[model samples]
Target chain A: MPKFLIWIAALAALIALPHGLSFSQQEILVFLTINVLLVASYRLLTLTGEWSLGHVVIMGVGAYSSALLTKKLGVYVPVSMLLGGVIAALIAVLLSFPLFRMKGFYFLIGSFAAGEIIRLLWKRFRDPFGGAKGIKGIDPMPDFSVGFYQFDFFEPTSYYYFAGVVVAVCLWILWRIEKSPVGLTFHAVHWQDKLAQASGVNVRAYRTLAFAIASGFAGISGALLAHYVGTINPNAFDIDLMVFVLTWAIVGGTATFYGPILGCVVLTVINEVVLRELGLEQMRPLIYGAIMILSILFLPNGLESIVQKLTKRRAAGGAPERSPAE
Target chain B: MLDLLAQTGLNAVYAASYISLVAVGLVLIFGVMGVINFAHGELFMAGAYAIVALYAGLNVPFFLAVAAGLLFVGCLGLLMEKALFRPLKDNPLGGLVASIGFLMILQALAVMGFGVRMVHIPPVTQEVIAFSEKVRLPVARLYVIIAAIVLLSALWYFLKRTKFGWALRASAQDPEAAALQGISITQTARIAMFIGAGLAGIAGALTAPLVSVNPHMGHSVIVTAFIVIIVGGVGSLEGAIVASVAYALVHTFVTTFWDGVLADIVGLSLMLLVLIVKPTGLFGSADRA
Candidate 1:
């Protein structure tokens, strides 16, 4: 019943991931892992009330930077991954200097613009990143070495488990941050920045750190995706992905830790499992649209809250109205 | 150089038309509902695909099909409000998340209904308006330009003259005050969604034959719409139009002169420039942020 149980269960799910899934289906679910990791990371930054529309752009920066460095400059994959995260963090921190002056929605808009700039730069450097065609066949992800258990990087189930593990690790790191004093500062900023500042919290410092940390994890997701697919396309890093992740985090319930996992898993499974099976072909969006509408209509608290209510109702006949305190 | 400039100018006109239509709808929704409709581009895509189904597949009259596309997508927006945004009224973030979910649903539906391939929305005209031998504008492009002018003007007139339009604006500017005066938030949101979505739909239907009509086509427009809204200043209807033209001109000219890759750079740089100088956007007032 601990959070660690969820991580263990996810790891078990990954081990059996490919039992029935086709190569393509496994591919989509793996992509969902990437989405889950990034969405959770995105929710981390959103805790401080710094909503970002350009996080996917940060992901692209990570993906392309690691990709191009390894492919062209002959850098090692692990080092390249580290470099990607570091660069993204540096960029976010530097950009936050001027952007931190703006409060509320203005900061959000500024970040969106910054993301567009990143996308443009990637496309502009066609020779390096393969432009629209994107860099093809980056160095394969090195085999993860653990004592005597060597996991092959080429297997679908292996990568699925790898993605699962990474997501779980990221989730734990995010959980740690949420429980840390920094988390309190972030929630304070989100709730009331003026009050937080009056209480001597360095609002700007915590805000920048939150945004940078999210970007760093996004970089990891991007790097993993690039290495997993062995191909990188500019299209994959487009603004639409950011919007999708934002939706996942929100619908999952940004206020709760488990919201994104539910948003990514449940919605994705529906999108894939139902939409694909019905072969509603192109018409599957109606089902998705209907679900979103209904989710918001009947349960504005998002899917996470729905899960909470269902679980609570089973435990007791009625649910309380207040948030359970930390 | 003259011919190249001429071509870029014509390109700007077409870009401006479509961008303005999409941006205006975005502005209208933002103004009234106080929620940024992330699915605005998908609504636009739905409009184009509507044309693909009715006009191209079912052989409906082109103009009537276009109108149907507008009305249908507009209804979809209204449904979104009643079903999604209305219940999450106090939570803008929830509305946003709902929209994100809505986008996936729309994209999936398009894939089911139309398949993933680009549907052929028959060209309205093959004629070209020649500015010179080396430079000409397609009649289809002109249609877009004309549509932008007429639709935007009609919107302005309605806002300036009509009772309902005033009611809509009043609700947008101050919902609580409007509520005090007996103007229903639900009614105003419905009106805003209809017009906002109708504009995006019509834009899609009109440009269907001109651009590739695929399930993912909304992706670019949404980003472009965001950039335009940001540059124009979010929640400002007039700001959207002016910024759209400015963005289109800059985007088209760069695209024409260099490559799309470079043009994107210049466009982002322009957005960044605006952010540094006027964080509220060119026309956006300080309070909206």
Candidate 2:
């Protein structure tokens, strides 16, 4: 079977298994599925070493764009969803030229500032995004099937399947990049940008492309979220939201493709299950912040790296600390 | 038109004062420690809440509360360095991530201590100096400006003249070399944390009454600080101050004439323009990213 077939089959299994799942279980599955897509999308950018802070904003753009188009313009849901991702990616590309120059934290800061600006813009223009009140009454995925056969998305299990499909496709795309030449270039830009530049990499172009791809994924996630939740709020795309997405990548680890999905799924579950039970709605951020601090101090390289170290330690038992002359 | 310009000028100066305080601290901490304090805004929030606890609740003198706020938050910074940032010194990202955690902890504590509703501190004074009926300068704003001038001047003097100040600057400029020259990196880190967190605290204490005081107020302040520092360049003290003043002026003036949202747009556009024309900022050198 082709690699794409494996991806499709994997996703199909995920979708089919939800047939007998409970409502709450289905919701959890959908959220986790969407988070995997979202995190992978974000990983696409971080893989290039850009540290794009505006990533949540790109998701916001996607969520709000598709949500608005479907609500007001009455466009087909699938097309609007695709359009949302496309618009967000296009905007990211246009903004990337001015933003991509500053390396490291400056790029992060610039992207953050841009995200704030976009958020304010969305809030300021009341006609389109429904102002602070937010656009409501989005039609959840309709049962009227197109050529692919219609299905009901309002039911929790069906939505999970929808989410699962998207996640599968995104994961495939991301994994392919990881194994491809572009992934090699991404490492070149990340680990040694100066050396890569000297070695004839179009460092600027690649960074821009990475950013656009990341934004595109965020858009895809946003669309999925809007369809699932049936409403989109501007508040969902601000710093808090941005930080929410970032927590996954940071806590899970940023060094590999699997880390962010691991982070998103773990945290999202914790948020839904443990946090709600504890009645710590107001203190959720406190928990998040504390985790961040402890993670930095003890797990600086993040959980993925930590796991690798542990596995190596358990496997090797003991070895002399190795250092090469710099 | 005259009144409008003068009003904008006053607003600009006020914005410049607080933002410069926050930005300068951010730079100082980043310079010395090689770690960005994501919780710097939380320090500012802690300052404001120090006032909320003291001046607003206990009816302490405003200036006294402000002083206490500075000292308390500065001490908190020292504690953070000793406990958190110091252990993670080998990993700057670790330090930064730890700070982010601290930011959440602080926010949570604030929420638990004080509910999330906006707390209105009775204005320190209602007195205003009038250029015209609409062109009024609140006496409270004058306090921020005067305090900025005196404090910044003293900081400059200390940085340029005093032996400890020289040690601090030396350590900031190059820690390994400073260590070779007999300066202690650990001591310098303590000093930087205290000074940096103190500035943010004081800025917050002074401005607490002007804006809505809430647990989440640190959000915008940090965002503003990030923009200022990036515009000022990562590691330049003078650049941080200059960029802060310039950004505040443009943002405030635009906010005053137009709306708050548009001003934000313009503030970011200014950042973009700076990045394009002078990526190092107005007074920045390009060593730190």
Off by over 4 Å in 2: A1-28, A144-151, A306-326
| lDDT, residue B106, model 1 | 85
Native contact fraction per model: 0.74, 0.75
- Local accuracy of candidate 2 as per-residue lDDT tens digits, A1-326: 67799888975776576776667867878877877888888888887777777888888888888988888889888788888889889989988977876777777777877787788888788888777767788868776555674567777777776677677787788789867998879877877789999999999999998888778878988888887888776787777766767778878887766777778877786777688679888878778777667765666556677666776876775443212100
In candidate 2, position A24 carries an lDDT of: 80
In Å, residue A283's CA in model 1 sits off its true spot by 4.7
Which whole-number lDDT from 0 to 100 does residue A248 have in model 1?
72
Off by over 4 Å in 1: A1-33, A72-74, A144-148, A160-168, A273-284, A310-326, B53-61, B287-289
Write the residue-wise lDDT of candidate 1 on A154-233 in tens digits.
87777887778777787788899988988878888877789999999888899999989988988888887888888887
At residue B83, candidate 1 shows an lDDT of 76
List, in order, the clash count of every candidate structure: 12, 3
